[model samples]
Target: MDAKSSATDAKPAAVDAKTAAAVAAAEAAGPSTGESVRIDSWIWSVRLVKTRSIGATACRGGHVRVNGERVKPAYAVRVGDEVRLRHEGRERVVVVKRLIRKRVGAPVAVQCYIDNSPPPPPRETVAAAGIRDRGTGRPTKRDRREMERLRGLGAGPGGPSGGGFAAQGRPGDRDPSGGRGRPNGR
Candidate 1:
């Protein structure tokens, strides 16, 4: 055989060997039954949880469920299974689209599941309702009262009976004698 032809023949054999090795590796790492993967592994592999340990912890804490039933970390998860994970104060609902045992990049991870979470609340409506300006110092009595009123916790304009402090004598109105000392002879 000419030198060029011999080199070309060797290339095909090398490619075939690489392909066989890949196939063996995939089979060894894939699910034993080729139908389902462990829930914790799947969650971590798909990037639903930051780590496998966290995914397992969530499962143990009852923060993860499959098809409305709480499942253990080693529970088998098959395609089309609905997984609900409650983490970081939010619930993520996703349907398994594919089974993955190894962690993948964000793009591939996203493809393994279909997210069904609700849209987050708007920023304006969810901002801290009682946030105060920085370096403003403590709120004045007037400001505190206004905040209480806004929260419907303060007495009304009619005084304490009406839900306000007006009826109660102010510090200045109190007698120095410690008694209801009539300042002007009540």
Candidate 2:
């Protein structure tokens, strides 16, 4: 009865109207496979990408290809079209088996395309790569030496010098007080 309650009730009606209109339009268009859909929308609908925005960004960045050629986001996708998407350092190759305008579940999404991507590369262990987790404190002298050795620096294995630093040590290593406290004087 209140204005706020009335407004809330009106909102759902508006949303329902919009949904009905969309359904009608889709019905008029007939089967999706018979009509071409935007490449970005198709990618998102088929779950090839996380979202339509990401698909659009990928297309704009030249990371999306259609039939072996780079294509814009608005490119029309039809049945049997080859779509190759390069994302996160990996390439996904899929051929359109069905066209869908709305996103579906993963199981259904998989049936929309024929995936031909290669197996992902083996994962490297953090310890093997000498990668330390954050907030673990700075590396110790031994850790530093090991890191430099892995990087082919220092005298551990491949380095020509004693270590990453010069043989005489750094400038900070010099006595700031001119060695006045020492018994020997030049």
Candidate 3:
């Protein structure tokens, strides 16, 4: 009909042709597992790390390992390889189940790897243990002494009760020379 309508019709045909070509090429290439992807790219693709650059940084920092050996960012990764990443004070171990080049959604990304990480430590035990109230502010001198006593560092049972000259009494309170403050009867 109109020129605009004809142009739109031609665009879809071109896109379809490209899609068909891509599918045919993929079929010809056979299984995806036969090809290896870069470790940094794979890590980012599977959501193991936030960004490809971060993954590369981690690799360079010696925080990434493949099959128990540290590997560089450009290292090739294949299916069935075990990857260990140390991040945020915890270690994550995963087995690669699929290889993907582009980053994917969380669900699909998770499907690409088999997580073998140990369970994270309980939050209460880590962050809440001995935690004081919000408005408590800094500890007072008495609180410090009590805490030291609890840790067996203060003068208490099971700890060294005061040490040196201070343990007895003040200099004027007790005569260290054994004159009883009379100063040799003078």
What's the C-alpha lDDT at position 68 in model 1?
Answer: 100
For candidate 3, write residues 1-186 as lDDT tens digits.
699999999999987786666544433442364577899988887787899999999999999999989999999998799999998777999998877787766656666789999998777775332355789999887777777756667675333666445565556774645665665555
Candidate 2 has an lDDT of 0.80
What value does the lDDT take at residue 128 in candidate 2? 63
For lDDT, the strongest prediction is 1
Per candidate, the number of residue pairs that clash is 4, 0, 0
Compared with the true structure, what per-residue lDDT tens digits does model 2 show for residues 115-150?
Answer: 999987777622465789999899998888888778
lDDT of 1 by residue, 80-132 (tens): 99999998878999998878788766656666789999876667876454568
Candidate with the larger lDDT of 1 and 2? 1
The candidate, 1 or 2, that scores higher on TM-score is 2
- What lDDT, from 0 to 1, does candidate 3 have? 0.78
Ten contiguous residues with the weakest lDDT in model 1 = 160-169
Candidate 2: 10-residue stretch with minimal lDDT: 24-33
Instruction: Please report how far candidate 1 places residue 26 from its true position, in Å.
Output: 9.7
Candidate 3 wrongly placed segments (more than 4 Å): 1-35, 127-130, 148-186
**Which prediction has more favorable lDDT, 1 or 3?**
1
